[model samples]
Target chain A: MNAIEFHSLSKFYGKHRGIEGIDFSVSKGEVFGFIGPNGAGKSTAIRTLLGLLHPSSGSASILGHDVVKEGVQARLKVGYLPSEVDFYPEMTSRELLEYHAGLYGIEKGEKRIEELAQYFELALDRPIDDLSYGNKKKCAIIQAVLHEPEVLILDEPTGGLDPFMQNRFFELLESLNKKGVTVFFSSHILSEIQRMCDRAAVIREGKITAIEDISSLLSKQMKKVRLVLKKETKLSLPDGFQNHHSTGSKHNFDYVGPTEVLIRWLAEQDLVDVVLTEPDLESIFMNYYQR
Target chain B: MSMNRTLYFKELKRNRKNTLIWTSIVVAFTFLILSIYPSFSQMGDQMTELMSSLPEEYARALGMDEGTWSSIIGFYSTYYGIYITLLMGIFTASTGATIVGKEERDGTAEFLLTRPMTRSTIVTTKFLALGTLLAVVYSTQTFFAVLGMNVFGDDVLWRHFVTMHVHGFVLVSFFTAAAVLFSSFLSPKLNYMGPVVGMIFGSFFLDAIAKATEQVSWLGYISPYHYLQLQAESGSLEVNWGSCIVLMILSLIMLKAGHARYLKRDIVG
Candidate 1:
């Protein structure tokens, strides 16, 4: 079953447009990455899916429950990390988690809170205001996952974290997905999405232009193969190899053929160091957004 | 019910500093005003002679014609009722404005709204938190006011204090509801000043119209401050139970409307 489904969802604030006709679905246990620029309706779409915002002219559902009509019920199975996580500054991490846990009727929430604290390497007793940005992000992450929610929706979850912490967060998300929890997250960082997301939807200007598997997306777009010749020798490349430019001893080719064809062509060339560069998610993301 | 209680307590915990500061100021102000009452009463004879020379309309405007000053109720009605009501209204407006709107200002609304709770629950919980704060402040002030008044050789009856406090309590709730209603509809940046200005100006206009013409006296019924008049008649100062009930119902209705709008409104990123 799809964990989330948006159908022609549109939202506008007075005369300004927010999102228009956003439609997508994340299947259960799938890591679906939502990619877009800052104002490409990414947050708006997530908010609408979470039932935090109402669509102006369409519908959304989670687990087959209508978001607008049965929001509370649908939200029960979901855990969310907002892009900007803000909580009561006076409360300690423990107190904040306990308060949230109380809403969900979690028993012995202190134990869960302690476990989360230990896992995230956060001090439960410290006030939220005193924590650093990365610690605060960890606190939010712990709170989001403590309930063991079936569906986790995170927006820019790793934005403030360092590279080490980002890797840890990805591991945590992977473990959660392994436990049959569906993960739906949005991020502008294409490389992170390429690594973490099984499938993704690229949105540009409030519209989803493409939704496809990560591997397929990279393969479909052209990859760059740069060959540095041992001796400046010219070789004839295949027909589809556009932009074959060379300077000094290095030859750059915008290779748009199969990996096997490129490998065979490189093997037939003179002694040289060849670098095969698969199209990164960043360039593909830019392709959608810039258009 | 549990969710509402949890959220209420959370709001209280979150707003402890602001609440404590406001409550302290209110208590200190009450003490200051009550301490100076004796000095004012010493000049009552001169003031009364001056009032007698003035026109009846002027005396009525100054609330001097209701010349029953022997009792605590009479003194409170003539001296501090209007002033306290205005103070309470301002406090109530500030509290209500911060309740729901503070979430937006602090960027916590998106996080809170994503929780597994209905928007009505959130609204009601915040409203309850504001009510709790008002009850605590008003009760504390009434306790101190009555104690202060008792030191002046007047028999401070429990019934009078209860009635006066009840009147203040209702108005606080009314103002809070009005502010929350506005907060839900307006931008967070304008939350504090907008509702306060509205309450002050709205009450002023309503009071002016009500006092200007007898035909429009019914308009007073629309103002929460009008129903909060605790010293209308001596020995017959009955609480307006009907209006009180109506005000409570209106507050709930307003809260419901806010919840409905917030639940449907798209949160701007």
Candidate 2:
């Protein structure tokens, strides 16, 4: 059975559309990515499946159990890491994790909690109110994985983390995926999605626009190219380049074609230096929106 | 309809500080009110003359009479009807209104509702914690009042005290349940203290005004405080078992409705 499925699931906040006809599935042990810009219903879809929001129509299920009907059963094997962390400010991280362990009926979660805390370099004794946003997020991660859940639903899990922590977190996710845990990863960061997902579903304005293998998605990668030339000279541009503008001897433009072709074109030019940068996710999303 | 013991206890612990603060206030007020009864009891003919001088309607409206100052229980009953029950109702009702919604308001609902427990269990557990808090505050105040009466007053009518307290307890419980029901339809970010105080004070004054003026006596039926008497009348008091049972049933219905509403609520973060 698929690890997670949303069969025409929809949610509305009264008349405001949260998500419309969201239909998708994550196969068991698959690292499936849900990608969208902010307010594009990525969180809504995740929240609905986690039973935080009641669907306006249709249904969702986790591990073959209906999210709304058999919510407890569905949730038993699922661990969720929310986008925003808001723990009870009065309790220390240790107290909060113990409380979380208590809720999941994990009698021996102390060892797991300590292990994750050490891995993340998180302080266990400080009150949540006293912790930084990044520390709170670390606490959130530890709680999410402490139960050894079979299905991991992570919504923007890397927010408020340093590069080192983010790296560790991704590594941990990779290890969990290797352990046969199905992961439904949701984020607006395209790089994170590209790095972590095997396949990804792109959502725009509460609708699933595209679902593609990471290989094909990478082939459509958009790059920002900047060139500083040897003297000012006009050169004919290729078909896939747009927004080309020049100031003095430097030229900048966005490219959305094969890197080799762009390189072959760049090699033919009289150049001082050339820079190719991955455009921001917003740009990538705009490219998808155009598609 | 399952109650989680772990959540139940955690909820209680969460509200422990507020409970301790409010409990201390009520207990201290109980002792203070009872401690001053002696000074009034010694007024004798002066106090009677004062009661006679006051407007009769005003006296009845405030649940006061000449005999109210004659005994410890009767004296305690007047303040209990006005300030004490109002205080208890406000604390419990405000707590009931926020216990579940606070999670939603603070963005913790995403973490909580995602847990391996049904929404019913959350509602059931939180409300049970609310009830336990009400009992703790109520019983603590009652214990201190009893101790104060023994220390400060003579010929204390213990039976009347029990009847008054039972009535007050029922009134507070019903208000707490009603607040839970009311909160389900409103935003969690709302300042419920205003409405909670309004409800309790509104019920008290409505009953008071109805008793004061016969023309508006029908209005008393609309308030929960009317059915439950908190003051002794005709030098005697008894637990109104019929009213108690009806209010208890209504409280249960409100709770069930609130639970159903909460179960279907979109716990927005």
Candidate 3:
């Protein structure tokens, strides 16, 4: 079953356009990444899905419930961590988490609160205003996942984390996904999505340009192969090789066809080394936006 | 239901200090006004004696004929009523303005909105919090004002005190509703200014129309302070129960409209 579905969703503020004709779906238990630059309507789409904003046109549904008409019901199974997490300054992290747990009607909420606090290695006694940005984000993440929700919507979840903490967050998300939680996250960091998501949608200028399986998208548009010959040599390339650029020591070419032709061509030359690197999600995203 | 109760209590806990401070201020001012009633009564007699020596136009211009020294109700109606009403209106409106908009100012709306509760629930909970605070403040002030009046004067009846307080509550309700309505539409940084300016201008306009022409007497009907007349000679100074009901209904309707707008409008980041 699809966990979320958006059909031609559009939003506008006065005459300023937010997003238009956005459509996508995330399957249950799949990690879907939404890749976009800042102000590309990534947050707008997420807010619409969470029923925090009304779409000017089209519809959005989560777990078979319309976001507009059945907002409370749709939100019951969803956990969200906003990009900029804010909390009551006077409440301690533990108090805030308990407050959120109560909202969800979680039984024995203290147990879940303690477990999440320990998992994140966060000090629960510190007031929210006294905590660092990363700690506040930890509180947000803990609150989002503590209820054991069926779907997680995270916006730039690792924006402020150090590399070690980012890895820890990835592991935490992976553990939750293993338990059948569908994760839909937006991020500017392409490598995170490349490594974690099963599928990703690239959005540019308020529209989704592509939604494809991570492997398929990378393999189709991002294969870059470099051939280094033993001696200075001019080489003829295969049919699918286009946009070929060369330096003195190596030739860089992008291909959209089978790898065999490149291999056959390399066999004809005295190649000292040949290196192939698939374009990461970042490169693919930049390429589309630049165009 | 339990969640709503929890949220309500939390809001109260967060705002209790400010509510207590403002309530104390309003009550102290009410008591102070009551304490000065004797001085004003003495002045009224001295003014009457002095007016006996003056021309009729000067005495008439000062309203010496209509003014009386013995009646505490008259003292309130002519002197303290409008002053206290304006004070209460500003306080109530400012409190309401800060209720919802402060969440946005503190950057806490994002956290609150991401919870499992619906948008309407959040708005309604905040509205209840503001309502409770306004009621507590106005009630406390009314209690102290009546206590001071009864202890200082003989002719002040308990029924008059009750009527005055009922009118105060209705006026406060109108201001609270107006402030909340503005808070829902304006940014938090600018929200407080709207209510303050609205109350000041609204009172001024009502007062001007009341003094200008007999034909414009109906304009006072639009002002919340209009129904607070406590010195009608015919003993017809009962509470304007119809206007009170309308104000309460208007407050609820504004709250509903705020909830709907907040639920549908996008956050400004």
DockQ of each: 0.69, 0.76, 0.58
Off by over 4 Å in 1: A227-240, A244-251, A258-275, A288-291, B1-3, B31-44, B53-58, B66-71, B155-167, B194-198, B201-252
Weakest 10 consecutive residues, lDDT, candidate 1 chain B? B59-68
What is the full ranking by TM-score, best candidate first? 2, 3, 1
Model 2, range B87-184, lDDT digits (tens) per residue?
Answer: 89999999999998899898888878989998989889998899899999999998898899889988888889899999999999999999999999
The chain A TM-scores for the candidates, taken one by one, are 0.88, 0.84, 0.91
lDDT of 1 by residue, A193-259 (tens): 9889999998887888989999888888778878898888777878658778998788997776677
Assess chain B of each prediction and give its TM-score.
0.83, 0.98, 0.83
Off by over 4 Å in 3: A230-239, A247-249, A270-272, B1-3, B38-44, B47-69, B76-80, B212-222, B230-236, B249-252
User: What C-alpha lDDT do the candidate models reach, one value each?
Assistant: 0.77, 0.90, 0.77
Please give the C-alpha DockQ score of model 3. 0.58
Best by lDDT: 2
The regions of model 2 sitting more than 4 angstroms off are A220-285
